[model samples]
Target: RRKAGWVKERLDWFEQMSQLAVDREYVSGETFLYLGRQYRLKIVYGSKRSPVKLRGKFFEVNLSQSMPEQDRREAVRRAMWRWYRAHAWEKIRKIVEHYSARLGIEPPEFRIKYQAKRWGSCSQGSVLNINLRIIMAPLSQIEYVVAHELCHLKYKDHSAAFWDLLRLVMPNYEVRKENLRRSGWQYLL
Candidate 1:
C-alpha cells in the first residue's frame, strides 16, 4: 500500500510539472515572472531589430503585424528566451563576482544554460553551471544557488564542512532555499 501511494504521488508531481511546462502561451496580457516579480506580456505588432523588451511592468514583444498567430507565438517564445538569457548572464555574473570576492577566491568560470533538474552545479574543474531559468527566481534565491555552488569549490561534497562554508557566506540561505523549493515550479518558462 505504501509503495502504491508513493507511485501515485510521483505521478501527480510529474503531471503538475508537465502541465506547467507545456501550457505556456505568448498571448498578450499573459503574465511572466522575473526576479520573483510578475510581468504581463504585451504583444505589439511592428518591425524592430529586437523582438522583445521589458518596459515598466510589461514585456513588450514587437513583431510584424501581418505575421500569422502561430508564427507570432513561436517568435515571442524565441524572443523571450533571448531576453532572459541575456539578462540572466548579466545578473548571474555580477552576483558571482560579489560572492566570489566575499569567499576570497577568484571567480570560477561559469555557464548559463537550460538544465531540466538542477538550479546550479559546480564541476570538479570548478566550472559553475547555472540554469538560465534561475533568472525568474528572486535575487535572494539566485544568490543562495550561486553561493551553494561556489561552496562546492572549497568542499567538493555536501558534507558538513561544505554546508558550513555556505552558511558563513549566506546566513539566511536556508530561507531562500525553502522558498525556491516551495515555488520553483512557477519559475519555468
Candidate 2:
C-alpha cells in the first residue's frame, strides 16, 4: 500500500511538471519551431546570430541579446516583416508597372503594411495597400493580389465587372485566389 501511494505521488508530480512545460510562455534561451525551422533563443547582446533561418522544414529565430521574451519576439517579427516588405515591393512594383502600361492606366501609389486580415486594399484615390506578409507567399499569388487591387481602380466593387477586369489581366485569377486563401496562414506566422 505504501509503495502504491508513493507511485501515485510521483505520477502527480510528473503530471504537474508536464503541465508547466506545456503552459510556459515564450522564454529566452529556449528553442522553438516556426515555419518548419528550429530557432535557438540566445540572450546575449551583440551576438552574431541571425534572427531567423529557413531550415528544411522549420524556421529558427535567435532571440535578441539581453532582450525580454516579448521584445525578442517583436524584434524577430519586425525583421521578418522588413525583409518581406522589401522583396514584395520590388516584385509588386514590376508587376504593377507592366500591367499599368499595358492597360494604359495610371498606376496607383502602393503601400505595404502588416495587416491582420487583409491581403490588399485600394482606396478611392487609387492608392493600394498591400500586406507585407504577402512577400512570403508564392510569386504568382502576389501578382494576383496586385492585379485584383488594380482592377478595383476601374471597378470599385466586387461586381461581375470587377471580376471581368481581373480576368482580363489574370486568366487564372480564381486559381491564384484559391491558392492565396489556402496558404495565407503561412504568411501570418
Candidate 3:
C-alpha cells in the first residue's frame, strides 16, 4: 500500500533521470563540447595511432579494428578524457599562476577533480581543485573559476575581500560566472 506507492514513485523518477546520463551510450554522431563549441562526433574503424581528434568542428574517433565494440567505446571515452585533461592542465595552470602573482599570493597546490556541482574548490590546506569538465566551457569562464578558487587561498570565505579581489582580477567575471552556472550542465557529458 503506502510503501509500494512510494517505491513506485521513486523508481519513476530514477528512470527519468537515467535517460539524461551521458555515459549511457556511445552511439556515433553524438555531439561533444570543447571550449564552448559543439563538435559533431563521427566514429569509424581504423588501424591505430589517434583514437580521437578534432577536425574543424567534428570530433572524429578512429577506433582500432582489433578492439571489440565495448572496448572501442571505452577507448573513445578514455581518449576524450586525455584530450580534456591535457588542455585543462595547460590552460588552468597558466591562469592560476597569473592570478596568484597579481594578488601576491602563492599558487595553491592545484589539481583537476571531477565534481557534480562545483567548477572549482579551495580546501583548508590551500589545495585548489578545478573540475576537468570546465575545460569544455569558454576560456573566459574557465579563467573566472580559476580566479575564484585562487582568491579562496587568500580569503577562505565568500566575503567582501574575496569579491573585491576577484573583481580586480576579472572585470567580466560576473558574466562568465553566470554563463557557467546557466549552461554548465551541457558540459557534464
Candidate 4:
C-alpha cells in the first residue's frame, strides 16, 4: 500500500512536468538548452553553409530568407542537432579524459550518438557511448554519467563492488542522478 501511494505521487508529478515544454517547433523565441542553461532560438536570414552559431544567450540559425516557413523550422532543427553533436563530443571527450586519469584507467574510446532512452552505456569491449542530448544537461550530471561508465571498466555489472567504486569517485552522485530525473523533460528538445 505504501509503494502504491508513492507511485501515484510520482506519476502526478511527471504529468505536471510534461506541460512545461510542450513546444517542439524550432522557431525564434522558443528556448533550447545547453549545459543546463536555456538559450532562446534566433532565426536569421544568411548563409545556409554555416547554419548554427551560439552567440551570447541565443542560438542563431542561418537560413535562406526565401525558404518556406515549414522548411525554415526544419533547417533550424537540423542545425541545432549538428551543433549539439559537435559540442557534445568536444565536452565529453575532455570530461572522459579528466575522469579516466582520476580513476587510473586510460580513456576508452567514446562516441556521441542519438539515443532515445539512455544517457550513456559502457560495453564489454570498454567503449563508451553517450547520448548526444545529455550534453544539454548540467556539467555535474554529465560528469556523473562519465564516471559511472568508466567505473564499469572495472566492474561489468551493477554489483555492490561497482557502486562502491562509483561512490568513491563521485561522492554526490545520487543528488545529480535525482536532479537529472526531475529535469529530464526540459532536455527532450
Q: Which candidate's TM-score is highest?
A: 4
Better of 1 and 4 by TM-score: 4
Q: Write the per-residue lDDT of candidate 1 for residues 51-70, one digit (tens) a residue.
A: 88888999998999888867
Per-residue C-alpha lDDT of model 4 across residues 75-180, encoded as one tens digit per residue:
7888899999999999999999999998998999998988877889998789999999899999999998899999999999999999899999898989998888
Off by over 4 Å in 1: 1-21, 47-49
lDDT of candidate model 1 versus the reference: 0.90
Clashing pairs in 3: none
TM-score of each: 0.89, 0.64, 0.84, 0.91
- Where does model 2 exceed 4 Å of error? 1-71
lDDT of 2 by residue, 1-189 (tens): 859987996787566545544432333545443322345443334547665544444344555456765576567656555545666678888988977875679887999887877989998889999887676677788888889888888889999999988888889999999887765654543
Task: Compose the digit string of candidate 3's lDDT tens values, residues 4-30.
Answer: 987996787566656556463555778
The best candidate in terms of lDDT: 1
Candidate 1 to truth, TM: 0.89
Total clashing pairs for each candidate: 0, 8, 0, 0
